[model samples]
Target: MNRILIDSSVHHMRIAVVENGKLVELHWESKAHQSIVGNIYAGRVENVVKGMQAAFVDIGQEKNAYLYYGQERATTDSNPKEGRKLKMGDTVLVQVTKDAVGEKGAVVTEELSFPGRFLVLLPEDTREIGISKKITDTEERNRIKEVLKDSLPEGYSAIVRTNGAKKSKEEYQKELDVLLKNCQAIQQFGQYAKPPALLLQEKSPALRIARELYASEVDEIVVNDRSIYEELLQAGEFPQEDGVTLLHYQDNTPIFEAYFVESQAEKALEQRVWLKSGGFLMIQQTEACVVIDVNTGKFTGKKSVEKTILKTNLEAASEIAAQLRLRNLSGIIIVDFIDMVSKEHRHLVQEALEQAVRKDRNKTVVVGMTELGLMQITRKKTRPSLEQQMSVSCRYCNGTGRYPSIDWTVSKMRREIESIFSNTIYQKVIVTANPKVLDAFCGKEEVFLKELQHKFEKTIVCIPMQAMAFDKYHIEKQKDS
Candidate 1:
């Protein structure tokens, strides 16, 4: 039976589902000052950039929203003489596709989808009846398709989720009717609602999980929030089981720790994941891709070297798939398995990994192993990864994972002194930074400080601030007498 746990902390929220003894799905949502994405907006087109084939939109935010020309659907009713043209001051119904990161504005699209418990409702296009690829049973797929065909409006299409695989046609129709009503309400509201208005908002994380993740196998849904618990009870039909329970955690310890999930969560964030067979996986995530290296940490099998490596690689294959799902890591992923001598061993390890990832709800494609003993795979990215949502780039190394050398620090200090002396306004300057930078400059690079005094003709003082980052320093100009 599966168990769903929600950690609804004010700073960050995490949801984890455990099936049997393995972690299946985990998601983290950050509550930083940044606006949440997927929010529908009533936006005004500020400027139409014909050169870029896009427009800058004002969505009542600091940075203007970005709308690409490709996001606009081609209409057959467009004027033949005028062609497609969007001018300034035009009001558009837009939904945020991507969150604003760094300097880039939020990416907006007119194509919007509302997620329901059993199906995803697409209002604009609906002729096709789609089912999740995870549902491999042809008979179950046909059953869901028949339910959708009979229940949905003429213009709407429904993608039957994997959760609806074994459900009766009557049961599937009931869920579809709820979604259809919800969509109709949203459309009616959108007609009279002010521009830059929210026509629909997704349900809370707990309800969403119950709808999307809960199946007949789920033993219990535990929640700490009393209000949300009551809401879930009234929201939909929960799966029935003999021992199934809805638990309300009222302990002093956090809900995650009470369930012994905190330690597992902490382990998920670490760089190394160790298997019982003494093999380990070293995971490193970069902006471009995630790299995983398999190693035989300590296990020397009671067999030949080839057997040991193959055994370790096979074990790492299953663990790699588990970690990918638990962390929700996406984009290009390259896994370096311990090199094997046998062709059969390689094929077995590859098949093992592919079979494990096939159970994932999101689409995953295992492109097999490369000649360099690497396995390449990709998973559809629906949201920012757990790491991206919870952590920021380090300030000290500026994400390079290394601090500046003593010589580099001294050289930068000398340049700063020279620039400060040329100004001629400061009587003294205080340099403050981490102990390493200070120790490097004051201990090994003291000669450069002396030479800078001779060159710049100014008194420079360096004081280490223990609170400063390793590569960060503050400079303050003193008042001249």
Candidate 2:
């Protein structure tokens, strides 16, 4: 059975999907500090750069949003403005397309879409009704198309989601009514509101995931936070017939700790993943792409070398796909599979890897292997990877992942001592360094400390700072006793 655990007890929200007691995906969100993407707004045109074919919109954010006229042509061309270009102080309804990354502000568009449980209601897009490609059953697809064709309100249309395949007519009408009501509300709110104001806020991360994933495929939704649980219930996305259980965890123990998902999450952040076959995968992420190297760790086969390599490569392929989803690593991915001598074996591994990534909801393309024997993949990125979100550059290494050797650290300390005593007027000198750095001062280096004390005619004390970086040191002087 599949279970979704939502832990909102902390300041940030953590949502995890567990299938048969194993964690498959985890999503983290914090609304207070992060950018607000997918939010609808009434924005004011601060500046229109006709040459750049873009406009800077003030959505009441620190940096103005960028809206490309070329990209906006499809969505905004039908606006009442006709052919007139957006001018300063012009009020336009926009939705955030992407969040702020680095120096770039949020990307907004005039294309407004309201997502419901089973359909995405396009308020401005009335041209046609579309069906989800995943719902490939011809008869069911035709039934859904006919149903929507019969009752689709005039001047408004929607894209039927995959979850709508088995839904009842009453269910369709109920959700449609709610979506229509929201569209009318947004229009009314836009009428009263001025530019640079939020018309509708995006659903919280927990609620959003619940709506998208709560079809018959999901078994249960367990939320540790009462407020989020209540919100999911109010959303009315889950049907009780799917053995779906919604339980508000009233106990003091957090859900992750109880389910042992915290440890699984920690492992996902690691670069090396050990497969059950004793083979392992080394994952590395860079600005260019993500590279995964397959290795045979301890697995030895009684069969030929080719068989051993093929078996390890097959196991690595499965783990690689799972790791990508768990880590939320996207962009171009290159997998270095253990080279199989047989052409048939190589084909099998490639097909196995492709099938494994199908479990991931994100769109991914397996580009197959190159002549040089590198397997390439392209996965769409919706947000930052787990490691990128959780970690920062080290203070000493500054992201180089390297630090000065112990001998170099000791020599640097000597230079720092001389410079400090010559400039300052004080008796006792206190030197504090990381515990690892101080390890060099043990019996042998103690002699150097004694010499420095004699040369300076002052007392010098070495203290170990556990929390300090190995290359970091602090020196302080005191008055004569």
Q: Where does the lowest 10-residue lDDT sum fall in candidate 2?
A: 75-84
Model 1 residue 474 distance off true place after TM-score fit, in angstroms: 28
- Tell me the tens digit of each residue's lDDT in model 1 across 164-222: 67767776677767777876776667666665666655566567656667643678888
Indicate the residue-level lDDT of 433 in model 1. Answer: 75
Local accuracy of candidate 2 as per-residue lDDT tens digits, 333-437: 999998887999999999999999998888889999999899999998667777665554455666645344444345456645655666567778788998777
lDDT of each: 0.72, 0.78
Off by over 4 Å in 2: 44-56, 63-91, 401-481
TM-score (all chains, Cα) for each model: 0.72, 0.76
